[model samples]
Target: MMWKIQLFKLNFDHRERDAVLETVDSGWLTMGERILGFEAAFGDYLGHGARCTAVSNGTAALHMALLALDVGQGDEVIIPALTFVADANAVRMVGARPVLADCASRSDWNVSAESIARKITPRTKAVIVVHYAGFPCDMPAIAALCRERGLKLVEDVAHAPGASIAGQMCGTFGDVGCFSFFSNKNLSIGEGGMVVACDGNLSQRLRYLRSHGMTTLTLDRHKGRAATYDVAEPGLNYRMDEIRAAIGLVQLDKLPAGNLRRKELTERYRRNLAGSPLQMPFDNLSADVVSAYHILPVLLPQACDRMGVIEMLKTAGVQSSIHYLPFSGFTAYREYFTAQDAPLAEEICSRELTMPLYPTMSDREVDLVTGALLGAVA
Candidate 1:
């Protein structure tokens, strides 16, 4: 089927094409100079002496973060009920139990420190916070809470790259900050991720865990920096190759402008959807935070039929999506992870609708989707 607007359109152009071709032509493909360059560029963007470890994907980043923190069996990691299932999966991959926490409120999709506190147990070893929809979570308070409780904090920053709170980047506030450069993220590199640490030692641990726990990297040996290598520990081969790293470098260069455009389009949608029955999450966010506006998800009225509304939009040549359904709603996770009463996340699941949003999207398209949503709800 065809649609007039897509839920997300790639911002690729000649630059992306040239990047891939150039990387292929270089003949140094496996996590070479390009990976180092991408990591360095990302660290510079998030300043404050941060370092990044490029990984295979966001889930790999999460897995490595957990392994670096030594979160294994007999430990519990708290994660947001509203985020993608990868968070819970990553926890499980490290042999840790995942405690699902509810969002702060109906208007706020981010999991709050209060909600997280409720899920804490004697075995809780870490807290993973998702900056849902590119909105910054109350990290300052969450970080403080984690510190007081002696729990490691990992920032699941897949939806947010340039997002900041009180003049600081979102990923820098936690023990391990994980980011995704998936096809639809604020910064697209098809399939890649980066992990940043609050300090140097943790960052080194992440890098070691990214490869097969080798003392010296293949790149180091290739550049004559090391004669031979030793297995420091058993690690996964979660290294990002040169092609994605090359593309990531280009995407990093374009992120600020792309985020700014998304902010503009998000405001345009808000203005156009004003007074509509649907409610936009983070509508009343504080002035100190800046959003990456990665997605345009809104909640429909309870009385509105979600599938019917989707069909209406489809007939009108508009594309729509759902951010996620609660993990407990799935059959695979039902027995492994017990379901708790998270009214906010459940309510969001029943009515969440994502409208078309992307950097290349125009104001007219925002108006078209908002108008279509109003009509569909009506």
Candidate 2:
């Protein structure tokens, strides 16, 4: 269906088109120099000598991270109950159990060190913290806790790319940081992701894992860099294509300015909905924290007619969505279906509503969305 104000609009320009066209004309598609270039540019942006490996998508990044970290059968990985399903899905893929950790509270919306500690056990191998709605989690405390317990930390940075805390990039804070370049993310590239590690060994393992565990790349063989190769271990075809990599480079250049615009727009939405029934989550962040402002998610009042509000939004040509439903409540996770462990998460998930938020979205659109929501609630 068409929308006068859809969920998100691409921040594309002639540069993206030109990049795509040039990459197509070069005829060296499929994880070639463009992928390397994208990786290098991204690593430079990440800084602190981060070893960046671009992957097929966000899920692939998550899978590769878990695999590289050796989080497999009989191990338990702690994940936020309120995050996207991909986290639990990735953990499940590796034959590990997903221990659902409740959100910090109605305001933070992210899994905190306290919540994570409560869920830890003898089998717990890793803890994956999602910076929900692109707000930085209390990473310093989380990192300290992980270090104390000898557990691995993986960051689901799909919602946060340029976000940082304590002068360190979000992805760099953990052992393995995974970023998504999905169409709706802060860095929009349609279908791509990056996995970064501060450890050289882990980075090398991730690099090999992304390309079917081969010792050498096809691009290297094509360029006669290596005459023979060996399969170090079995891996997947999670290599990103050239087109998306080229597009990602362009997106990277535009990220900072775009994030600032999103920050401005986020404040606009807050002002517009000041007296509305909906309550915004993830506020009162640290002064050192820098958010990418990837998406805008607000909480509707309990017992309110959320579905009716959504339908009313549709009539006004506005589109909205739920950021997520708790993974525990899904049929796929029946064994782990108890919400008792993550009552806060279940409570927040029930009322969480994701409104339209994108860099290109205008103040007028923000007002329109808020106005429609207010009318629907009233």
Candidate 3:
């Protein structure tokens, strides 16, 4: 059913269309100069000598990062249970066990250092931290713990691209920073992803692994820069196409302004929802952090019916979504972890409701959704 307000809308324009059309016209649709330009531009945006390898999607980025780090059989990767299932699946794909961590609370949906510490064991090779809903995780504390325990840190930065914590970018603080450019993300490009690594060697490995372990890209061969290429090792066809890369370059340019707009909308939600029954989530961002403002999820009161609220909103011409169901709560992952493993995650998952938030949403739309929510609960 269509609603007056949508959960999200793509912030595309003729520019994205022109970029894709131009790529098609060039007859270079695979990994090419556009991908390289996107990577270089993203690297500069990431700063701190961060290098990016454009991939097919966010899941590919995470998988490549894990493979590049040699996280394999018998090893365990700890990740928060509150994020999308891809994080846990990536660990499993690498032949590693995923030890689920819990989010702090409904008010703060990110995994705390304490949660990570509890899940860490001798087999824990790394920790994958998701910057849930664009809120930066406590990277400094988590990094310190990883250092103390000699564990690698991988950042699942799908929700955060320009987001910063303590003046440092979210993707740059960890060993490997994986990003997604899904249709609804802050940096949407239809379907694309990137992996950033501070270590040059690791970054090189990621680049090689992104395109089937080829010693050289097809672009090099096409340009006559290389006579032939060799397959160094097994890799996947995870390379980002030229059209998506072109679109990503455009989206990347708009991210800062878009995030500013989201911030304004989020503040409006905070003000409009004040004294209302719904509980707001993740309003405790430190002064030093700049969130991507990817989503606005409020926790419904326990006394209220979650589905009833969503249906009410729909009847009132508003749309809503759930950020996620705890990964451990899913059938595929249940055997690997139990509901009791992350109590807070399970609690938040049941109540969390994502309100419509996007760069193109109008003030009137925001007001409509908020007013509908208020009347629904009332």
Could you tell me every candidate's TM-score relative to the true structure? 0.98, 0.98, 0.98
RMSD of each: 1.1, 0.9, 1.0
Worst 10-residue stretch by lDDT in candidate 3?
Answer: 325-334
What's the CA error at residue 308 for candidate 1, in Å? 1.0
What is the overall TM-score of model 2 with all chains considered together? Answer: 0.98
Look at candidate 3 and tell me the lDDT of residue 227.
91
Q: How many residue pairs clash in each candidate?
A: 0, 0, 0
Model 1 agreement with the true structure over 105-205: per-residue lDDT tens digits: 98898999999999999999999999999999999999999999999999999999999998899899999999999999989989999999968888888
Instruction: Compute the lDDT of residue 188 as modeled in candidate 3.
Output: 96
Model 1 / residue 142 / CA error / Å: 0.4
lDDT of 2 by residue, 207-277 (tens): 88998889988898999999989999888889999999999999999999999999999999889888778
lDDT of 1 at 10: 89
Task: Give a tens-digit lDDT track for model 3, residues 103-195.
Answer: 877678899899899998889999999999999988999999999999999999999999997778989998999999999999998888999
